[model samples]
Target: MSFEIIGKTEQIELMASGKAIHDLSRLEKQYGQGKWRKLKGVALVRLRNGKIRKAELHWYEAHGIGKKEIKRKRYLD
Candidate 1:
């Protein structure tokens, strides 16, 4: 039961919702309150036509979610 999400705008929107969903009461009892980070990265992409392009990567990281950290990355390039 797993799937992948693609797109920068969609990923950022999801981050907003995830941030709002997390609070003191919902924080994992075993861990401290968590924080989030968005890292901008780059990658190489090959198109259908066999051309290589530089891609912009949008990666979001969050911790303390039920004892596990979640990371989501999006491509915008």
Candidate 2:
């Protein structure tokens, strides 16, 4: 789903890190080599439909590569 984050993510938590990430190789191949992490957070997002809602987001991140493949995992409200 396509959406824009309306504000900062809150309740940030790590779901996985380093070798725990199954897509480690793909992440590095696409973004660059670094310590990769999978995380989940809550934030308000403006979806493609132009409606705003709270959602649980999942994404991958690396030191210098930053957040990648942000996805809306579920609607929180």
Candidate 3:
């Protein structure tokens, strides 16, 4: 299923301008599928300042959580 942000561009811009960061967890919950893989693990990104970052997939869980609760993995490349 395709994921959609439920807010307008102005709302997004407002959030971006604030100290509070966007929630990736919410985005993934609404749009993610396909074995719940990490996007950063499979894709490459370059910052505007010319810094490149790489990531690796990892399995993690919080206390009192089950394996199925494992969230997206991330690592620096």
- TM-scores for all candidates: the values are 0.31, 0.95, 0.22
Order the candidate numbers by TM-score, best to worst: 2, 1, 3
Show where candidate 1 strays beyond 4 Å.
1-33, 48-50, 63-77
lDDT at 47, model 3 = 44
> Which model, 2 or 3, shows the larger TM-score?
2
How well is each residue in 4-76 modelled by candidate 3, as lDDT tens digits?
1122212111112112324436534654422232111232334456654443322222224322322223434
What is the C-alpha local distance difference test score of candidate 3? Answer: 0.30
lDDT of 2 by residue, 1-77 (tens): 58999999999999999999999988888888999999999999998889999999999988888998999999988
Best candidate, lDDT:
2
- In order, what lDDT does every prediction score? 0.41, 0.93, 0.30
Q: Report the lDDT of model 3 for residue 25.
A: 60
Judged by lDDT relative to the true structure, which candidate is superior, 1 or 2?
A: 2
Question: How displaced is residue 18 in candidate 3, in Å?
Answer: 31
Q: Per-residue alpha-carbon lDDT of model 1 for 1-77, expressed as tens digits?
A: 02222332221233333455454334435445556443444455555566555554444445643323333233344
